[model samples]
Target: MAATELKAQARTGVGKGAARALRREGLIPAVIYGDKKPPLPVSISYNEALKRIYAGGFLSHVITLDVDGEKHKVIPRDYQLDPVKDKPLHVDFLRVGAGARINVQVAVHFVGEDKSPGIKRGGVLNIVHHTLELSCPADAIPEQVTVDLAGLDIGDPIHLDAVQLPTGVQLHGHEIDPTVATIVAPSGMRAEEAEAGAAESAAPAGETKE
Candidate 1:
């Protein structure tokens, strides 16, 4: 996909009063920092900022910032929103340099649910992590991690090692391999299994429980 370009203007003021003044003018206060460079104070159109936030993967996708004719490669590090109106208040963008690998949380998508034998048998798909933190090339970040559920059986777990990730992307900050999801038996099936186990435990000398 083509990169998104956002236009911004260099701002000269600081403090709450100045920020409020910008907000009244339909602009959002923002700062671009990182990559060993001094922070650049800027303001963006409030409507444009809000629209990007409403769009999914705003934080994950790499974007270009056109600040007063100077272009910058950046990714949204964080942002603040108004509690009452849910409007964008401020934004923090991190500068992305060449060959830089940044950590980001990518959404998870499970596919082939109907093809999974366990799911067909009424087994529940229990998700452990809805998003996985990954470190990858700043320009090649993945939109989401897709997990294939075909042929998975009850009691089977979907582990991070089993899922295929996009090139240049790898799990970040994890010391041990993690389970993304698990297939669990249905309530009725679980009850039946428990009852059968109890009966087997009660039997002695190979004799069946009455």
Candidate 2:
């Protein structure tokens, strides 16, 4: 993935009042740490940061921070937003080394739903895991994991082992490979409705006692 270029300026003050002032001026306070380097306080344009965040996958995507003409390769570690206004408040970045290994949560994408045999049989697709944490080299981070449901049957399930990981990427730690998605029969409520309708239609007509 291409690096998203962001321009930021060094910040001097550190306090709630200072942060509020920066927000009032359409700026977002942030910090960059990791790689055994001292944490550097900085501020970035709120509009620019919001744009990146809205572009999706901002946390997993590599970003280039330009501070006073110096470029820093970093990834978004955390961020905050105004609870009421839903505006960007602050962001945290982690400086990555050339060969650094990092743990990140990658999103899962399901495909071939229309071609799934289970779906054609009126089975519901139940997702067990929506994301998986993976450990990989900083430069080799995967955008997302794909799970195909082309030939899955009603009782078939997709597990973690079925996902294909990119080179240099692996599941983080000894986490058990759990079910990612599965096909199940339709809801019991629908079955009950059908049974009730059949019983009412088969009932004998009431006779008039005149």
Candidate 3:
């Protein structure tokens, strides 16, 4: 994962008016909290922040925030967007400590679909969960998890336990392992059934009419 560097200034004012004023000045209002520290209000360049956010995977990527010359390692935790224009309004950053384990949702990527027996047999792939919540070391967070569909057959369900996490990473909670995906009969099967029913209904009916 590439680290993105962002520059910000510490803000003294708070609340709606201050936020609006900051936005009017082409800045974004933000806050950094966590690691037992006080919540720090800050402001950053709107264009720069949007560029990083649009760069993709901003939430999962570790960011290096330069707040008034002091560097902080953080990750974007939450953000609010304008409902009408869909522009970013506020952002919340979570400070990460060295070796600290943080819970984050990691995107799951499916691979080896061409090798799956189910797919070869015209089985449809049904995804149950697109992401998995994981607890990982701050410095070792994985960008995404890969789930292989090789050797999978129709009616085979992939479970959470089948995924392999990197070293220093683990499932976030003790909840029961859930199904990630499964293969089932394709939609064409339903159409085929309907066609079969229609064929049976049409057969030999003409003789009775005569």
Using all chains and alpha carbons, the TM-scores for the candidates as numbered come to 0.91, 0.87, 0.87
lDDT of each structure?
Answer: 0.93, 0.89, 0.88
Steric clash pairs (candidate 3): none
- Winner of 1 and 3 under TM-score: 1
State the lDDT of candidate 3 residue by residue for 32-102, as single tens digits.
Answer: 99999999999988887777777766788788999999999999998887899867888999998887788
Q: Model 2 misses residue 98 by how many Å?
A: 1.4
User: What would the per-residue lDDT of candidate 2 be over residues 1-210, giving only the tens digit for each residue?
Assistant: 567789999999999999999988999999999999999999999999899888878888888999878899999999998899888999999999888988898899999999999889888989987888888888888889999999998889898898888888888856678888899878874688789999999999999899
Q: Candidate 2: worst 10 consecutive residues by lDDT?
A: 184-193
Residue 96, model 3: lDDT of: 89
Tell me which residue pairs clash in candidate 2.
none
Model 1 residue 155 distance off true place after TM-score fit, in angstroms: 0.7
- Segments in model 3 whose C-alpha atoms lie over 4 Å from true places: 190-210
TM-score for predicted model 2 compared with the true structure: 0.87
lDDT of 1: 0.93
Top TM-score hit: 1
Pick by lDDT: 2 or 3, better one? 2
